[model samples]
Structures are given as structure tokens and as C-alpha cells.
Target: MIDNNFKNEKAPRNLGLYIHIPFCRTKCLYCDFCSFVSRDEQQREAYVGALLREIEARGTKDYSVDTVYFGGGTPSLLSAEQIGRILGEIKESFNVSPDAEITLECNPMTVSDGDKYFKELRALGVNRLSLGVQSAVDGELKLIGRRHSFEDAKATFLAARGAGFENISVDLMLGIPSQTLDSLRASANQVIKLAADHISIYSLQLEEGTPLYRMRERYSLADDDTAADMYELVVKMMKDAGYRHYEISNFARGGRESKHNCKYWRLDEYLGLGLAAHSDFGGKRLENTRDMERYLGGEWLEAASDISNSEREFEFLMLGFRTADGISKSEFLARFGVGFDEKYGEKMEKFKKMGYFCEKGDALALTESGFEVSNAILTEILDFDY
Candidate 1:
């Protein structure tokens, strides 16, 4: 049941919409996301139908959507019409902002007919494109089970440009099989030459049960120290190229940061739809079922939990520290009714002495080196026994 307070509130809250398209042409060796390669058109159509039904069932006028993100096993794998229908349903269900930042994640291999595909998406209101390029070296790409070559990625990017996309982001990986400093530099330089609006570089994590993890011994991966060096090098390169390091793993040109993703780090409200999607709204955390059969049959929710005040406080600090701006002292007090210094002053002083933490104006943030070992630092600092 919808909350009466939410429906009767004078001002509607800003919300973000995340639609998961769990379909892929081919799964990457290192991938563990909920996705599969399905050639059955009927099954895909059925999934889309289920999504439309869910949107209607959950639709509410109490929230205004400012961002819409289409993420998945290559969301571009869906037909343009299917993508349009999903967006259309969202608009019908919610008061989507006129200038909402709508983003879609695409794989180069899936958008081979890039010109037509991207043009259709552009016409359907997708203003941002996130291409999964991973690496620019063909050998590195092949080793990671990516089907497209670097050239193919470049062409896809250009095609999106030609189709009138001004905001495009590319994904890059740091530590991969046989990745060296020189090769990593080359890849970074190549991506920079593309002049993309945004870039997200992440270290490769070999998840358990993935092909790369199962055959981990077959490939040569970088050591922790070498991977750290590569990270520092990329940071310098991005700084020299005039990209702002807004978040731990993201860089953007002036005024081109990902608005949708920022909502997550800021702990803003958002609604996630589709198979295995997760949402945090109205002081509640919810996740959709990972089972495709259940999702297709309209079983949307897998689990739901009410967030405690302490958990919210810890999450605010944890997620806020992931960004370069860090957390605001006044804002923390306003939200939790307690001064941050009163709670974490001792820990902050210790970290400051170690040169790992600093206070800029009214906000407290971690240094670049601090971000490298943030997991340990945050674990120690936010270990409240409440």
C-alpha cells in the first residue's frame, strides 16, 4: 500500500529510475551480473511485457523522476522499439523531468549497426551513452572474453557522436590478464583521444564462480603494488587531460559528471525495476528476485527491509567518502541530529595524523592514498556498536 503521507505531501520528492535489461549477446569471462545470452524473441518480448506491468503497478504521482538509467548485460541488445516502450511506460507512471538525464549502457559488439541503433535511441530520448570498452588492446580484450576489438569500439563511439550524442562515457579496466603499465598507458591515451565526456576506470575483480576466477592460474595478473602504480598513473593522466576526478573510479569533463550515478553515492532516493534490481526509498531497502522465471511471471520483490537510523548514518558516511567531495559535517548533523565531530573526532584526528584524511571547508574527505585503503579505514571508523 502507498503511504498516505507520501501521497498527500505538498512537495513531491526527486527520484531516480533504474531499469535493468538482463540480456547480453555474450557474457564476459569476468562478469557475474544477472544476464544471459538468449536468442528467443518470444522470451525477450515476454520480459518486456512483464516490465510494463510492473511499471503500471508501482506507478505513483508522489515522486518526480529526475534521472533514468538503463543498465544491464548490454541494454543496447534490446530493440529500439523495446527500449522506447520501456521509457514511455516510465513517463506514463511517473512525472519524469523534462530534462531528465537518461543514460543507456551499450556494448560495442551489440551496436554493430551503430548509426541506426544510436540514432533510434537518440530519437527515443536517450541523451547519454555509456560504452563498455574495457581495454583498447585487442589481446587484452580477447583475454577478457570481449567480442569486439578496439577498432570496433572506436567506430561505435564515433557512430554515437554522429547520431548526435554529446555526453558519452567509456569504461576502462586497470588490472587484467597481462596488463602492463605501458599497455595501460596506451589504452588511457587512446580513450582520451576520443574526447569522451566521461570515463570510469575500475580494477578487474575476479568474482567467485566466474570463468576468470575458475581459471585464475592460466593468466598473469598484476600484483597489488603494480596495480596501485597503474592507478596513480591514470589519476595523473586524467588530471593532465583536464578531467575532474569527481569520484573514486570516475572522471568527467567540466559539468559532465554522471547525474544518475551521483544519486547513489549521495544516498538519494531511487526506484529499481527488472530482474535482480535493487531500490532504496522511503527508509526502506528492496531488491527484485534474481530468478528470471519469477521475474517474468511478475514476481518483482525478493526482499525488503526497513533501514535503521544507525544504518542510514553509516551508509551516508560510507557512500559519501567514495566521492572527492566527501561528507558534509553540517549535513550529517542535520540528518542524524548529532555532530560528526562528537562521534568520530578521535578517529578523524588519528587519520589526519597519518595523512590519510583531511577536512576541506565544512566537509571531510580522504586523500587519494586514503581512498586506496578506504575499506580498512572505513571499517575501523564506522564500527559503531549501536
Candidate 2:
């Protein structure tokens, strides 16, 4: 169905594929993602089958897939065989590049037999692993409803390495319940000791309707000021440890950034293939149905809207600012036929003078202080009617 809409494409483009697995063992207290806690193997198999069918129906040989990501409610929850089947279908349906960066998000607790499990995944062409090690503090982990302990995460990381995985990422969280500066430092130090290729540190956001939000009064969550202090400390620590703060929430060794994620920031075309997954492709924005029954019944599309030029411009600036590299002035002009300064220079000069913005060579990026209050700055600067 999607193929018919984009059949007149003129040239081949590189694509990133995102496959969502919306099943988890237990939902975290702060999670708002589209995931269900289900142990029904039949349901999992049925979901996989639907994904395979969608891949066949929408996939085109017109694009070369350079990155494939398995994200979700713990993608590693699926057995290696199931993951392999999905990857096999994708390869058969699309022109997947030989050196495509394949990444899978894993929960440490789900890796029952890490050695065998990770080895099988490696053999299936999955080259990167993103372990959900939310905190190295066992108490904090418990308070956050994480099933895996710090030890479990460490063991899983070691096992992934034993399975020949070189590109591994560990996730850490700030502003968890009962998180103090010392506890935050300990968590950061412990994850750093693992020497993972990438580390993603996120500030926990309390979403409405989540368990954490309802119990907000019960926990000693870090205040705004404390959270900002924690961020500053971690940035310095990561830089000292030779990791680049490549994005607002991501740190990585040189040349180890997540290729699939960069596609989103760069506004490159990517196709999402699962329930509640979203795709920005064929000059349109598409979202798959969130209802499980609708998804399993082969009614995939929930919404399809054309992305207007102005919307694209806003997104290019918004997403680009999330990265340390920011936006390229030349590329902006080349793509939109308008000079970046001609459009935004007047409004941004105040912030630049105040040390919130920086221009290095061709890149216009936000300073560290700018990232601190990026929301306020973006609100004021991205106010143009065009």
C-alpha cells in the first residue's frame, strides 16, 4: 500500500528501519511507552507475523537500508529465533546494506542466558546492544521498579562482550527517587567503569498516569536545581573519561554514535514497522495504529499527513539543536533556499551575545549553558511565522 503512494520516486535514498517490540516483562513505574506486560508466547508470535507481513507489503527495493533498530518494550525479550526471523524478512524484502548498523535494545533481566542469547543475536547480524541499566544503585533501581540489579546489568554487559559485541551502550538515569549527588556520581562512575562504547544519561521525566507520577509525593526526587547540578557533574566526568557529549543525553567514544538515531536528528528518511511505530518517508509523516487488535488485524496506518516545508524547517532546527554539532548554515540554505542567518540571525543575536549560542566554522550550536535552558530559548527564538 505504501509502495503505491511513492512509486514515482526518482532516485535511491538511504533508509533507517525501526521495528518496535511492544512487550515487556514488567512496566517501569515511570514508563509511558506503548508496551504491555504479557507472557503470552502466541501473542508475541502473532505480532511478529504481522510485522513480517507489513514488511513485505511496504518495503521497496528503491531504497537502501543502512541502519536497522529493534526498539521497545525490551526487544531482547523475544527469543533469538524470533528476532532472526524478523531480520531475515527485512533482508529479504529490502536492500539492506552489508555494513548496516543493527541495534537491539535489551533489558538486563530479560537476558536469561546472556552468552548463548547474545551470541545468537550476533550471528543474526545484530551488531549493537543498548542495555537498559537505568541506575547502578540497587536501592535507586528498586525504588524505580527496575527488575534487574546493578550486578545483573554488569554481568549482562560482560556476557555481551564475551559474545563478541564491541559496540555496547549502557543507559543511566538522573533524578530518580532518593537520588542524591553522591548516588548519582556512584552510578555514573560504575557505568563508566564498564567502558561501554556509548552511555546515554537521561533526566527522568514524570509523565502523568504513570505510577511514579502518582507517587511523586512519596519519593525524595531531586529538585530542579539539584538535577541541573547532576547534569553538569556528569558532563565533566564523561568528557574527562574521553567520551564525547555528542547529544544532549548521549555520550560516546569517538565514532561510536548511534547511526540509526542520527538519521532522526538529521531528518533522513526512515521507515517504522510495528504497532505504534512512526515513519517519516516519501515526503509524508505516518504513524501505525496503536490498538493491538487493529495492528494484528493488518490495519496498520493510523495517520498519514504530508509534512509542510515550514514544519520541516522547524523540525530541522529543533532536532538539529539536540546534537552538539547543531545545524549547518550552508546545508540549511542549500536545502531550503534561504540563508540561516537571513531567517534567524536577528532573533538569535541576543542569545549569542549572552553566551548561549556559538558559531564554530559552519556550525551554529548551543553552548552548554544554552542546553540548560534550551526549552525557553527555543520557545523565544523559533517564533517566526514562516
Candidate 3:
């Protein structure tokens, strides 16, 4: 059952919608997400049907959706008709803003044609495209088990441009097996020249069950210091290339920041649909079960955990610090009934003196170096329990 608490709330309709597609052509060696390699047409169709039904069952026309993100194993794996129908359902079921930022995450190999699939997706209301171009080197891509080569990624990017996608984001990986500082810099430079509207720089994690983790000694991965240097170099490169480092791992040109992802950093309410998705609504956190059978059978959400004011305060500070704009002191005071400075002023003074923090007007944000050690900084703050 849909939670009544979210429905009863008097807040303005600023909901975001996220649709997860859990099908991929091939699972990457390092991927641990809820995705699988499947060519079962029936299963794909069935999954879409279940997703549409869930949208109808949970969505309200009264809620004004500002953004809709179709993210997944590979959203572009579906036919153009399938994408259009899913988008059509979302529009019919909700008060989606006419100018809503709709994004689709795709793999380079999936949209290489660009003339057909990507163009159709654009016409279907997908204004932004996030292409998974993990590296610029073919060898690194092979090490990471990506299906597409660097040439394929370049071709896909050019195709997206030809297909009329002005807002394009490319993903880049920092640490990979057999990756060196020179190779990392070369990739970063090449991507910068691509002039993608946005870039998401991520580090490779050695998840326990991943193939890379299992055969860890086969490749020479960059050490922690080298990885940190790689990140710093990338940050400098992006900035010099006229992109703003708006978040810890995200850089955008002009005002091309990701609307859907910004909702996550701001703790705004968003509804998640599909297998293994998560939702934050009714003042609680809810995660849908990962079981495909359960999701398709109409058992959608798992359970809800109500958020406390204390938890909210902590998140506000932590998430806000991740952004370039930082936290708003006035907003904090308004939300929590206490001045932010009064609560954590003394604690932050030490860091401020160390040049880790910058205070301009009413906003307090971390410096670039501070972003490097954000976890440690956040942990220390949480430990103090202000």
C-alpha cells in the first residue's frame, strides 16, 4: 500500500521520479549492482509492464515532477518503442513539468547508431544522455570488462551530438587494473576535449564477489596516494576546461548540473520504481526488494524507517558539504530551530583555520583538498555529535 503520510503532507509538489532498468548486455567485472545479462524478451516486457503498473498504483497527478531519470544496467537496451511507452505512462500518471529534465543512462555500444535509438529517445522526452565511457584506453576498458572500446565510446558520443542531445554527461573511472597516472591523465585530457556538458569521475571499488576482486593480483592497480593525485589532476583539468566542480565527483559546464542527482544531495523527495529501487517518501526511507520475482508479482516496497530531526540535521550538513555551494546557515536555522553556527561553529573553526572550509556570506563549503578527505572530516563531525 502507498503510504498515506506522503499523500497527506502539505509541502509543495517537488517530487523527482527514478526508473531503474535492471538488464544489461553483459555484466562488467567490477559491477555489483542489481543488473544481469539477459536477452529474454518476455522478461523485459514483463518488467516494463510491472513498472508501469507500479507507477499507476503509486503516482499522483497532483505531484509536479521536476525530473525523471531512467537509470540502470542499460536503459538503452530497450527498444525505442519500449522507452516511449514507459515515458508515456509516466506523463499520463503524473503532473510531470512540461520542461522537466528527463535523462537516460546508456552504454556506448547500445547507442552507437545514434541515428535511430538516441534520436528516438530524444523525441520521447529524454533531454539528457549519460553515456558510460569509463576510460579512453581500450586496454583499461578490457580490464574493466566493458563491452565497448574507446573508439566505440567516441563514436557514440559523436552520435549523441548528432542526435540533438545538448546536455550530455560522460562517466570516467579513476582507479582500474593496469591504470597508471600517465594513462589516467591522458584519458582525462581526451574527455575534456570531448567537451561533454557534464562528467562524473568515480573510483573503482574492489567489491568482494566481483571478478576483479577474485583475481586481484592479475593487474597492478594504482595505490591510494596515486589515486588521490589522479583525482586532483582531473579536478584541475576540468576546471581549466571551463567546467565547475559542483560536487565531489561531478563537474558540469555552465549550468548543466544534473537535476535528478542534485535532488539526492539536497535530500529532496523522489520516488523510485522497478526491481531493487529505493524511495524517500512519507518522511521515511523505503527500499524496494531486489527479488525480481517479488517485484514482478506486485510486491513493491519493503518497509519504511521514519527519519528523525537529528538524522536530518546530520544529513543536511554532510550532503551539503559535498556540493560547491555548501550548506545554507539560514535554511539550517529555519529547518532545525537552531542557528548552524551556534550548533557547530566551535567545531568547524579548527578546520576553517586549516583552510579546509570556506565561508562566504551565509554558505559554508569545503575546499578542494577538503573534498579529498571528506569522509574523515564527516566522521569527526559525526563523532562529536553536536
Which candidate achieves the best lDDT against the true structure? 2
Candidate 2, 182: how far from true, in Å? 0.7
Residues 1-386, model 3: lDDT tens digits: 22223222466668899999999999999999989897898999999999999988987876799999999989998898999889889988999998999999989877545787878888898999998998999999998899899889989988888989999999999998888888988999889888899999999999999998998988888898998898998999999999999999999997999999998888888999888889877588889889899989999887778887787887788889999999888778767778888878888888888889998999889998899988888788767533
Residue 215, model 3: lDDT of 85
Q: Candidate 1: TM-score?
A: 0.95
lDDT of 2 at 349: 91
For model 1, where is the 10-residue window of minimal lDDT?
1-10
Number of clashing pairs per prediction, in order: 0, 0, 0
Q: In candidate 2, residue 165 scores what lDDT? A: 97
lDDT of 2 by residue, 1-386 (tens): 11212222465578999999999999999999999997999999999999999999998998899999999988999999999999999999999999999999999889899999999999999999999998989988988889889999999999999999999999999999889889888999998899999999889999999999999998888888998999999998998999988888899996899999999998889999999999999889999999999999999999999987778888989999989999998778766778899999999999999999899999999998998888788888897443
- The list of candidate 1 runs beyond 4 A from truth reads 1-12, 384-386
TM-score of 2: 0.95
Q: Cα RMSD (Å) per model?
A: 3.2, 3.5, 3.2
Please write out the lDDT profile of model 1 over residues 63-150, one tens digit for every residue. Answer: 8899999999778888999999999999999999999999999999787588999999999999999999989999999998999999
Error of 2 at 309 (Å): 1.7
